[model samples]
Target: MKYIFATFLLLNTFHLFGQESAPINHELSFQFDNDLLFFDAGDRYYTNGLFFTYRQKIKEDRSWSNLFGFQSLHKSIFHVAFVSKIFNPYNLKGEKAEEIDRPYAGELYVDGLYTSYWGQNRLAVGVDLGWLGTKTRSDDIQTNLHTTFGWVRPRGWRDYQIHDTPIAHLYTGLSREIVSIGPLSLISDVDVRVGTINTNAAAAITMRLGRSQPLDASVLTHARTGERIANDRKCKELFFVTKTQLMHVFYDATIEGNIIGEPSPFVKSAEPWVWMQSVGVMLSMKTFDLQALWSFLGREVVGGRPHKYGTLVIAKRF
Candidate 1:
């Protein structure tokens, strides 16, 4: 952890001192998802969680121009995130609770990405390094469990846990706008990941409605541009967005079924695939953006119930 911090600081220093033309952007955001808000019918796949992220972007030209000074050579992004996850109601109460609950876990990770663009299409490669373990307090876990299940007995110190391990994941993604009709646009994206502990692939299609014009080329390709520089667009805009995705999981090292000596014995076998659909609205202005999305997920595990979750994101850019 100390080394990671040191590296981050060093990189930031290089960014700050390198060149005058280099531009940087940063965003702070929070996201939360819970099953209780789904109105009691939804359950498995994922339960409830909170995630906080800090992201920094450096423009490609500037990065490449300052490469001799330890600057990046491609459009680069760095992210730091904190995550917390809580178990579902059924996992908290059944006779097999101790073996299946998983209770809760806390994780912290740092991610780095390098991206390149061709017209409106983008290609990105990234890696995530983190630590995941059963560090969340049992009392807090019980409180959330009670909130979701109501009047459930606390499980005491008996809980399931994944053995602490450093996580390393590498991935690549491609995204592009496929079509446009007036103020509406269609976009597609696909991503694949392989890690020391997990492997998954996903593809998604999305539609955006109500923009006066298509997103700027830089924004479309997630690159830095004069629009981000001038920062003159204080006028707010509203849009409705919808997305559908298909995902497949080949393995998960954190789940008990895939790792030896894992204390959380919830799943005896891995579920290979899942599907998700979401609808949302986005509001964006000069320096602020907010989005609210409702999502439905298909069954991820055999006999597991399909579920619904909501995500709210608020971001401030600088």
Candidate 2:
């Protein structure tokens, strides 16, 4: 933690040198999805997710860039994130077996995304590559964290984890704003992912009110622009948003286990459909942007309990 603080101070020293329209912006963000923020029991299916992300602009013209013709787009960016997701069953103290509501599993992966934008719309493609099961070290990370914090020791994860296996996933997303009314507007989004780790499709609609930049280059929607010197805008924004989402599942290795290799000792049926509701707010200053969101979800597996998680994001612009 101290090392991170030192690095932050070092970067702040470059604020002046970072003044120009270099046609690039860098953001480091940390996201935590956990039910504890809502003061719930906090342990069970879709238990917790932690991610670290770094994003920056990509140049418009490189031999490789020629493939995308990025100059025609409003903005282009490349971002990478390290993700850790843990899944727990209804009973953490029970003996490991198929009798549980869900299997014990963990995923540790690195994902990269490329995104391009046009007015009020954006397209994104991404890939996730890494390991699933015991190799992800979820039990170790969780145990150490819990012990240090005096939280309950996750004893059952070790006995119940799925066998180690490799994973790969490909995904794409598109979003567009279909209506606008001064401070209020509506946006629609659709996304899909397919691979060894997870296969699913989702559609969402969001209504936002208050102040914001256009969708083509607004940080609120993660459509950040690399084409302008951020300070040049001098816009301070605050906005409130609400969203509804529905998803259909095709496969979920986290619960079903990988289809091949040494099969896990246990697996379960993924729910065919799930619903989600979210409410959030975004606040932006020249130095940083802050977002806070809370989400409630219908069960992801048969007979599973409903769940909720909170997200907080702080992004620096440089």
The model with the greatest TM-score is 2
After superposing all C-alphas onto the true structure, candidate 2 shows an RMSD in angstroms of 2.7
The residue-level lDDT of candidate 1 at 16 comes to 27
Query: lDDT by residue for model 2 over 179-238, one digit each (tens)?
Result: 999999899999999999789999999888998777766766665536455554464678
Tell me the TM-score of model 1.
0.73
Which residue pairs in model 2 clash with each other?
A: none
> Which RMSD values do the candidates have, in order?
7.5, 2.7
Give the TM-scores of the predictions, in the order they appear.
0.73, 0.89
**What local distance difference test score does each model get?**
0.58, 0.77
Clashes found in each candidate (C-alpha, N, C closer than 3 A): 0, 0
**Candidate 1 lDDT by residue in tens digits, 46-149:** 55667667766655456442333432233445556676554443454444543453333344466666655445566677788876655445346645766776
Global CA lDDT of candidate 1, please? 0.58
